[model samples]
Target: MVVKTLNGAKAVAEAVKNCQPDVVACYPITPSTHIAEEMNHYYANGDTKTFIAVESEFSAISALIGGAATGARTFTATSSQGLLLMHEALFNAAGMRLPIVMVVANRAVSAPLSIWNDEQDSMSQRDTGWIQLYCKNNQEAVDSVIQAFEIAETTLLPVMVCIDGHYLTHAVGQVNIPPQSEVQDVLPPFKPKIFLDPENPLSLGVYTNPSHYQEFREDLHNDLLQSKEKIIEIGKKFGKRFLRTYGLFEEYKLKDAEFVLVGLGSVMDNVKATVNELRNENQKVGALHLRCFRPFPSEELKKILSGKTIGVIERDLSLGAQPPLYTEIVEALQGTNTIVSSFFGGLGGRNLDRTAIKVLFQKIKSKKPLKEWIAQQKGDQK
Candidate 1:
């Protein structure tokens, strides 16, 4: 393993090369474009066999679907609107159980049209039947991409590795890129269970009537839920091999804390720093980072947040109702005494500083509903 200072996209590209995917489908978009760019460099050097540059995000994922269906390991990366553009193909890939791994440099979807960081793009497709794994930093982003292929190939389901755009994607950080020889032991060659073979032809994605349609959906849902076990198992194996631990969610100084903040992506760095400061001030505060967002980690989350005052910090909202992740937390802690609250910030890549996090904790302590904006604009609202 060699430790190198690299941006999140570059680190991920390195990991992808080490894993040696059979096919790479790339479409350019901000922040996420670097991942494809670096991978193209690998292709230029003859490190990768199949590198496809498609016209659009939709075409990119369509190519991935074909690659995966042909019994080849496939990968792609996109951000915000580009990801949304692949929405239709995303479901098709997951529904067909392609195990295509993708990286989403999480950015905001637009009506006002700003190409900035937010969770809205991926969160909007939370129910698309893809395994969503979020990273807090460049190192985690690289590791997540490596593990994603393992998890996706294991379960025969697609995986989406999400990293905060611009914040982590562009920021240079020290990352340990595992050697191809070492990574080979961790992630073996992809041997697909089924594929489009001419010799033994088989029909895939056949139309089903109302009678079998519901059953098919049920099986997909159940399979996804059961995949949680494999997720945990793979994480443990990775840790044993690499000395780096990962899980569905990571708890930070939560033991005996009365109030805790829950969030994902790069914002957790600020939350952790703020938690340490609050702890020094004799405050019982903690933070939880949701690494695995798709499975929701309900039982585990409920076990930890049973009686604490929970503050959910989200980069995306459901609009006119609860925020995306906050709603999931509320459902998870349904029968518990957890007083759940919401805190939204960092929209359109707005800076969410330590002051904002501290103020969020303060509001949680005072039992005051946190409805104030944490960005450049200050306001009071109900």
Candidate 2:
């Protein structure tokens, strides 16, 4: 392992290079552009095998779909509108069971047009039949990128490793880049069970009549649920080899705590810090950092937070509905006595400092309104 001070984009790019993907297709967008640029540099130096510079995010994902169909290990990166543009291809990639891995520099979607960090970009795609992993820092980003390939190949499902745009993507920190030789031992070459070959000539993603379409959808759903086991296994294997273990979610000071804060992505860092401060003052507050979002981890979450006072802070909103993460946690603890509250903040890169987090903790402790907007003006809580 080699330690280097690098930003999240560069660290992720280095991890991808170590994985030695067969093909890389990307269209440069803010925050995610540096990842593609770094890969291009590797390709120019004859370090990477294939790098395709596509015209748009849709085209970039389309290229990856083609590459994965041919049994090639493929990757791409995108953010904000770029991720939205690839909406159509995202389903096709997942429906076809392509084991492609992509990195999402999580950014806010448009209408107001912001290039800053938020979970809305990836959160919008939660139902698109892909595995989603959230990273808290550059180290987790690098490790998740390396583990993603193995998880994707094992489950035959596309994976999106999401990092908060600008927050982590542009922030430089010390990251440990595992050597290629060690990575190879954990993630070997992609030997797909099926591929596109003229000699074998098979069909994929064909138009299925209503008679069988539902079955295909059902199978995909079941497989996605079952893939959670493979995710855990691969995570444990990686930990054994690299000494850094991961799981569906990370618990910080949750044992015997009366108040718990739940969140994902980079915001959890601030949440954890707030939890520590509150703990010092004997506030009995804790935090849960959700690492795997797509699989949902409802059962595990229910067991951990069943009877506690829970506060979920998220960077995205569902408009007419409650916040996405908060809604899910509510559903997960439906039968339990958990008093769950929803708090939304940091949308479009608004600052979510320790002060805002402490306020969220206090609100949950007092059993205030079930839904509040953190860091927003007082009257904005409608």
Top model number, lDDT: 2
Q: Give TM per candidate.
A: 0.96, 0.97
> Per-residue lDDT tens digits of candidate 1, residues 1-382?
7999988888899999999999998876553559999888899999988889888889999999988998999999999888989999888898888899999998888787877788999998889999999998888888888899989998988999999998988889899999899898789788887999999898777799998988878888888888888888888888998998888988999989999999999999899999999999999999999999987789989999899998899888777777888889889999887788888867988877788888889889976546534555353221
Candidate 1 — which residues are off by over 4 angstroms?
29-32, 368-382
TM-score leader: 2
TM-score for candidate 2: 0.97
**lDDT tens string, model 2, 1-382?**
9999988899999999999999999886553559989999999999999999888999999999999999999999999889989999999999999999999999888879888888988999999999999999889999999999999998999999999999999998899999788889799789998999999999889998989999988988999988889888888998999999988999999997899989999989988988888889988988999999988899999999998999898999888888889989988998887889988878888878788888888788786547878776444443
Clashing pairs in 1: none
lDDT for predicted candidate 2 compared with the true structure:
0.90
Worst 10 residues of 2 by lDDT: 373-382
Q: Model 1: which ten-residue window has the lowest total lDDT? A: 373-382
